[model samples]
Target: MQNAKPLPSYLVHRYHGWKATTWTENRAWYRRLADEGQRPRAMVISCCDSRVHVTSIFGADQGEFFIHRNIANLVPPYNPDGEYHGTSAAVEYAVTTLKVAHVIIVGHSLCGGVKGCHDMCTGHAPALEEKSSFVGRWMDILRPGYERVKDLPETERLRALEKEAVLVSLENLMTFPFVRSAVEGGEMTLHGLWNDIGEGGLEQYDPTTHKFVPI
Candidate 1:
């Protein structure tokens, strides 16, 4: 707590503005949500990128989606070794506790985390290759994905790797026993999505064709 700092002036101003406007206008809705608790129908796993706004993209309300954001939006394979697994814990709660009907993995174009993974895989990012780098260890989950698209041209490789992040997460999600059971029992469904930040384009993975199509 000694290292904690007060909110910046800009953020303080913005908070007051939002509280006076948005919160004031939705006081009843906010109170209802606080009393009833959240029962979001979907869980959205997205990147820690500032550009990727999950709620805004879906025009969702505050309690509509149970969202978890992490580097590269990657989900590691099920490893219940009693260690701290933030993403896994979020997924577990969403599926088992919240009983969300759908789980969505969203990747985005020009993702820094995905690019870091690509660079590390290609030996271009020595810093990320270090054993002490938490990011490097986390990104190891996407190594298989990088291998799949390493042969492509430079222009396409990054984009492909970005989409691969979503694919890899989706595949890893199934590794969780509860997720597999829920999906197989038709209690839940999984989805993969990619967003083009500059172009404002969104694409959904088509399992039937193994390709991404504009949605």
Candidate 2:
């Protein structure tokens, strides 16, 4: 079992085709960017789910997005303690050091993290207190959003709450001095996106319309 037989037929075929030609030839560019400090133009907060690779979903090339993903793509209000704060630190660095032009908070359909938050608010979530898991801690950021939208229907409400969570993170983005300063100076913009995974469609939040507009 240790000695694998042969490459899978699909991968073997792909290796002789697009994957081989494109990514293989482009490896040098990626290496060069890494060798130099990457100055990405955008910062994306996305889901930690394996299925939602932000770069792949956005069709972004290497070094294009300074991306951070937590459960449900949450961004806690700026809090700088001595302990590990991976997501918040990434945001601070991106907005301050990297000076990204835009920050996008991305949410998606049928997100497990969103479901977890919903369940937690309704007292139906798994007994998570016993374990010190990142998911448990990270989902806390969506608590306010869940509570605010709890009166809506289950299927529709969860989805709405998920979008509300993205907006909440966008609000959190403003809590950072660097981000707020940049936006006030008209140097940066914040956006919230909701992706319908079932239909492979995207909607951008419009504050004026108070709705998600297909994009």
Candidate 3:
């Protein structure tokens, strides 16, 4: 901590802003949420992109959604190997402990992590391909999704893989026994979403239509 810098001035200003307006307006709701504990109705798994604000995008109040973020927003297939799994642990807690009724995997355009994975796989970024690359290994979860969209034009592959990341995560979510049980028992629902950051548009995956439709 000796070498660590103080909090950014901009963040300090933003916190003051939130405390003044957003927090003040929802003071009672915030207090109630604190006293009663969080009972979020939904769990959202999304990318760790700075531009993606899950709560703001959904217009959710404090403690309304349990969110888990990771590179490319990809969820690895359920693996109980007695190893550290942050995202899976969050999902477990959300489903089994929090009893969330819905699970949403939100993917977005121009995701750096997804782009890195694409570059790594296509030999565009050799550093990420190295075995020692932590990000490279984590992004490997999206490899299957990339394979599904590999044939698209160079310009379009990235966008296709972005959606594929959501699809893969949705499929991976079912691999969790508790998640599958809840979903099958009609206690929980799963959703996939893709957002176009530049366009400010959202698309939801429609299983019946097997497509991502504008919502």
Candidate 4:
């Protein structure tokens, strides 16, 4: 038998076929969107992990949220001198330009990046002192996680650290002037979330509760 190529139906998205019907369903809404412009309601900052997909979890439509993904979902402290600042740039645009009402930092359990940080902390692996490792440097933002959860056992400790990293990123998001101003002005709210892809449960942070509860 000849080696057959994948079907066009498999390669081509079904959404492309639904264009006419989709537009018809929301014709008036789309007309207003064209006239006004896209104004997304929320902005999501999530990890670049292939296992954790933000769009599917949020059940978001295309124009509902602006998304930014980086290693471990870290939001670094704002600095003009830093050579790489793509994440910060995205946050600024979402908050200042798009004027999103919510900024969500979603982390996940069993993250490879977080596990790498855990390994470095336990001295199980050699310290990545060299600048040559791009991913190692990116994982640096979650370094503090190991120390903070060092007292607990490996399993529980790592889970706590993973959640802690989300909180840390939420704090880092506030360091940006645009984020801070929007938050202070009641224009935006910061949310820290953890998704357990392995188990299929969502936990959202609650300020008053000071803990994550199933949502």
Best by lDDT: 1
lDDT of 1 by residue, 1-215 (tens): 79999999999999999999999999999999999999999999999999999999999998999999999999999999999999999999999999999999999998999999999999899999899999999999999999999999998999999999999999999999999999999999999999999999999999999999999
Each candidate's clash count: 0, 0, 0, 0
Score every model by TM-score.
0.98, 0.85, 0.95, 0.83
By TM-score, the best candidate is: 1
- The regions of model 4 sitting more than 4 angstroms off are 1-36
TM-score, candidate 1, is: 0.98
The collision pairs in model 3 are none
Which candidate model has the greater TM-score, 3 or 4? 3
Q: 1-215, model 2: which lDDT tens digit per residue?
A: 98978989998898789667776798788679879979899999988777776786779987899989888888898887788888889998898899999999999988998888787778786664336756767788888897789888776898898898898899898998888999999999999998888788889999998889999
Model 2 TM-score on a 0 to 1 scale: 0.85
Model 2 lDDT, residue 49, Cα: 74
Give each model's whole-structure lDDT.
0.96, 0.86, 0.93, 0.84
lDDT of 4 by residue, 83-144 (tens): 86898889888988899999999999888777777776676656553477677777677776
